[model samples]
Structure formats: C-alpha cells, structure tokens
Target: MKTIIIDDDATARLLIKKMCNAYSEIEIVSEFSNAVDAIKFLNKNDIEVIFLDIHMPLLSGFDFIKTLKKATKIILTSSDENYALEAFEYSKVVDYLVKPISKKRFEKSIHKLKSVIIKDSLVRDDSIFKEKQRNELYVSIERRLVRVPFSEINFVEAKGDYVKLKTDDESYIIHSTLKKIEAKLPSDNFLKIHRSFVINLSKIIDIKDNSVLLQKEIIPISKSRQIELITRLNIL
Candidate 1:
C-alpha cells in the first residue's frame, strides 16, 4: 500500500520507514515532522495508509484526520498508551502502537490493512443497496440520506413497520423492516443487541444488569440475545 509517515519525532519516523522498506509492496512517499505539513501533503497526494503520532506540536494526529475529506487507514504511534480507547472512536484508525515498536508488532499492524479494505468494501455494498431501495421506501420530509458511519450508530429500534436508526447526534426513521436494514449493516462492528435493536458495539458506554447504555440511550437485553450480545461486546 502507498503510505506516509507523520511523526514529530525523527527517530520514530526513521524506524517506521525502515520497517516499511522491508516489505516489497509498501511504499514510503513522504515524511513529516508535524501534522500541518502532513495535512498539506495529504490534501494533494493519494495515499492508502498513514503512520501518525498522537502527540505533536500545534496540530495533533487526531486534529489532522478531522480536516481530511477522504478517509485513509491510520495507525497511531505514541510514547504513551492513554489514547488507545479514544483512537477507536475514529473509523480510520486501525491500530495503536507504543514507541520503540518491535518488528513483529509492526508486521501485525501492516496485516491490519486487510481489515480496512474489508470495511471499505462493505460500505460500498451498503451504498449500492441503498440506491436500489432509495425509491422503494424513503421518508419524504426533504430528508437527506446521510452516511452515518458504522462507528456512530448506537443502536436501532424496530417499530411495527419501520426501524429507527439512532446515532450519537440524531435519529432517523427509515421506512423499512429490521431484517432488511440489518442485512446491510456490518456484522463485525454492529450486533443484534436485541430482537428489535441492532447496536454498534464500539459506541456502548456502559452495561448494566440487563441493559446496555449506548451513547445516551439505554437498550434492553433480551433473554435469548444476552449470550450473543456478550460474545459480540468487548466487556471488561
């Protein structure tokens, strides 16, 4: 994959570049000492993956991603491990690595490129499915079909004839059955939390006795689906 190195630390960037050089398929197009230069490069250049450092002067790795129009796979490199959970919030961030990265772990991170490909492919499929059913059952309220990232949706609530897609900021009521929408959703990121609810496992805030707190909504756990939800969720 075509790649770039964006880290404030010179040594860290060099190490990653060396590691990437070992692989025949990987290409190191550019390197930046700060996110601003990297952002500028990204604006014009085409890249598939980025090795970014979380802590940088002025512009952070997190902030740089926010400015991008096209999302590319990111692997965060840092001296500390505090930002691991926050890294997962971004769909583009595939992995987090601490400083002094070992060759073994570096290779593992490269292997994660396949996962990014899979997710991008699934989203393409979802787009095709939406276009096929666009005229079939769509709400007519000057509604815009927003691409709610798989990471943003908390859970879905099924009514009699429609399903409500609940996200972090808002909810949209689509004129469709749970089964149809469920088929379009990515199985790896989202789970059938309940018979009537499909939830994004990453957005789960807390898990109570018989319910899961997803964002601001609390979804019930059906007796039959509890085991399945447990398996899908990474509960600590």
Candidate 2:
C-alpha cells in the first residue's frame, strides 16, 4: 500500500522508514515535517495509509485527520499511549503504534492492514452482490448499511479467517466463519460445493466439468460435493 510519514522529528521519520523497509508491500511515497504541507500533498494525491504523529509543532495529528473529508486508513505513532481511545473516534485511524516501534509490532500492524483490506474488499463485493438481488442481506459500507437479496447470492468463499460473499453484482468479505453464516442461510437452496465455498444450487446456470457456472463466473465443485449437487437437482 502507498503511504506517507508525517512527523516533526527527522530522526523519528528515519527510524519509521527503516522499519517499513522490512515489507515489500508497503512503500513510503513521501515524508513531511509538518501537517500543513502534508495536507496539500494529500489533496492532490491518493494515499492508502498514513503514519501520523500525535504531537506536532502547529497542527496536531487529530486536527490533520479532521481536515480531509474523504476517509483513508491511518496508524498513529506516538511516545505517549494515552490518546489511543481518542484516536479511534476518527474512523480512518486503524491502529495506535507506541514508539519506539518494534519490528514485531510493526509486522503485526502490517498484518492488520492486510485484514482491513480483505474486509473492505468483502464489503465492496457484498454491496455489489446485494444491488442485483430481489431478496437480500444487508451490511455496512462506509457509514451506510445496504441490503442484498438471498436469491441473487451466488456463493461464499473462505479466505483465511474471513468469508467472501459473492452475488451477481459483486462480492463481500465479513470477518466471520463460514460455518456460522451457513447456519443462517436456507439449506434447501444453498449447498457446500467445497471446503472453501458454499454455492446456491438454483443460481447455477450450467455445470461444466468440475465447475458450476452462475451468470458469467465459474465456481469449482469439489469431488466430494459433485454427487450431492447432482442428487440435489432431483434428476429422474
């Protein structure tokens, strides 16, 4: 992800940059000693993440985040641990990394960023999926909650600890286990295709080789579930 460092101390900025060198995914696009110049750069360019200092010379970190109308993820860096709760009120702030930040702690923060991206992706997918349905399930996106019809749901895919709900319009990720959501769904219409996915039987437009086609997307049907899917179709 693209990121920028905003801190008054050059030494602190250098240290933070050095720590970021450990990861290939994170790139420091620029660094600013004050929030004023940083704000100008941010206005013109889009940044996925920010390493913001809690205390600065003129404009504090809290005030800097407030200036931007659009939301972007932030990780607050500070010597003091007191403002952690206050920082959370700003939806953009994902974590509070206490200084001097350890490599392990920094790595942990990177992991968190990955999960956030996955969760956000899931939410986006879910929103699109819901938009095309007649009977839908709703979830939060940005600040608003939207609905998606159950019939339009194509399937759900599991990635690590998260689940991706795929529909006709898009797919969504929720930080939930598949088993938990499986219980909530109607088993009569949906069937587990693989260990990682659950497909809507009625939504299958075609079954080719080892995969099932829904609309334009092709989803794999596991060897174990192939017979069950065929049987569920009630072939004479």
Q: Identify the leading candidate in terms of lDDT.
A: 2
Report the Cα lDDT for residue 181, model 1: 74
- Per-residue CA lDDT of model 2 for 1-236, tens digit only, reads 89999999998899999998988888999999999999999999999889999999899999999997766789999999999999999888888999999999999998998788789889989988765442556655556666766787889888888888888888778777788767767789889988888888888888889999887878898999999988899666
Q: 139-208 in candidate 1: lDDT tens per residue?
A: 3333765666665677778998888988778788877878887777777877887889988888888889
Alpha-carbon TM-score of each model against the true structure: 0.53, 0.56
RMSD of 1: 16.0
For candidate 1, report its TM-score.
0.53
Candidate 1 lDDT trough over 10 residues, lowest sum? 133-142
Off by over 4 Å in 1: 129-236
Error at 196, model 2, angstroms: 45
